[model samples]
Target: MKEKITYQDAGVDVKTGYEAVKKMKKYVEATKTPGVLSELGSFGGLFQLDLKGYKQPILVSGTDGVGTKLKIAFMMEKHNTVGIDLVAMCANDVLCQGARPLFFLDYIGTGKLDSNQAAQIVEGVAKGCKEANCALIGGETAEMPGFYEKGEYDLAGFCVGIVDKDQIITGKDIQPGDVLMGLPSSGLHSNGFSLVRKLFFEKEKIKVEQYLKELGDTLGNILLTPTRIYVKVILDLLERFSIKGLAHITGGGFIENIPRILPEGCRAYIDTDSFPIPSIFTLIEQLGRLEKKDLYHTFNMGIGMIIVVDPKEVDPITKFLENKGEEVYEIGKVGRGEKGVEL
Candidate 1:
């Protein structure tokens, strides 16, 4: 008889894939929300819309990947926290439109299947879903042997949210004299890692385990810190305040992201000294010999999210956010003449 080559011989292992699914089930179950109508293994993620208070309900969707930050996770041999980064990158963007995140789905592509590692990654995802008040409906785990490196994997996420049309923040109302408030970021929050990697690993030749007194943590730990989800606080603010505009500081940093919501003839004037910049950013700036403008144009610095509101509403909003344990800073003000950001 001719030799028979099984599917497992070709690199994909069905049995191992099944084991991974079994390991991930419990973590997936913990993220269930009322809107989730399907299980983890379904053909599609099902979320039943709850249109109780919304008259003209609008659906907002966002998708993002962790980018080169995954390289750091690979170096640290840590598989958990990147899943949270995956969810936050998407959920935070959807929140910019003043939407409540309803459900999330993730994708994991790897060369070989490791059940424990897959479970750990999903556990992080579930934890993030709980924090964001969203459900983990469904996802994919692809095993392609030759396509990826042995111990490395890629992760991406999709988030769906809902908001009423009238409640949507379009920044159309942003005018001169409007106050800009900022919420502090946890750390690097998963952007500019390509430059970071070059500065630390390639140029400075710093090891991941190296400790820095300025940051008070190991280099790897600071770089791997998960992105913060602003859904809950922003949603609460929407109910009690007239928020003119919202911006989630992501890949573009302050220079690019803040202008995204600015209306015609309105510019943002940010007082950079208003908030304390995180040490990790400063380290990158010094090591890379980058200019101040380059740093703000590439990283979030310290501010992760920005809220635009009328000057009259700043005091009350700041008080409410402070009461919620958020570090609030009166970062800037909207100005006339141009449609961009001024540091």
Candidate 2:
């Protein structure tokens, strides 16, 4: 008789998947908020909206993945922090709309399931959810044989947030003479990695373990720093300040993102010297011989989040943010011109 085949033989292991779910359960539970109605294994996540103070509640949703930055995580063999990047990418986008993140779900696709590694990744997701004041209600782990390479996986996240209709920051109020304040970035914050990898690995042929004086750490460590989640601070600011517009500096950087919140007749004038650019960006520019416009067009260049506010309120807002230990900079101002950013 011919030997019987099993799902394991086909490269999908049900038992291993069960083990991974088992290992990740605690991390998932730790992120539970009052609104989360379903457990981690539920078919769909359930969040009870507390509409106590909201007259017209609006739901804001965002989804994103950690692009080629995953390559750096793969090189470092560290799986913990990438999940945080996955959550931050989605949460920060939702935050730009002035929403309070309620819950988050993550998806992991890989050739094989490693329970320990999967658990590590989920731990980071839970940590990020806690920081963002959201719940990690549900997620999926797909094991597809021959789909992804060995020891490699892809991650994506979905975030849902709530905002009152009147409280939604639509950037419609952004006008000429608005002061633009910036929140400093914690390194690259998970964008422009394709260019970064080419410069460091392909062109310069530098190893991840190599230490540089400028960065003050190993390339892998610096590159693998997780994206920052500004949800908590921004939410607090919303309550006490008259924030006109918010821009989460992501893939497009200053040139593309800043214009997103600009009004029709308003343009953004950024003083390049207003905030100090991180050394890693300077290194990339020097190594790649890139132009100023191209660098600002691609990476955050140092500022992660920009706040557009009434010029009169700048002093109070700056004081409030600084007391919270944020490295705030009065980076620029909105001016009367075409709808774009000028550096």
Query: What is the lDDT of every predicted structure here?
Result: 0.91, 0.92
lDDT of 1 by residue, 11-116 (tens): 8899888899899999999999888889878899998998999999999999999999999988999988988989999999999999899999999999998888
List model 2 lDDT by residue over 1-343, tens digit each: 9999999999999999999999999999999899989977879999898899899999999999999998888888899999899899999999998999999999999999888889999999999999899999999999999998888899999999999999899899998988999998888998999999999999999999999998999999999999998998999999999888999999988999998888799999999998999999999999999999999999999999999999898999888888988779999989999999999
What does each candidate score in C-alpha RMSD? 0.9, 0.9
Error of 1 at 218 (Å): 0.6
Q: Model 2: which residue pairs collide?
A: none
- In angstroms, the error of model 1 at 15 is 0.9
Q: What is the TM-score of each candidate against the true structure?
A: 0.98, 0.98
Model 2 residue 74 CA deviation in Å:
0.8
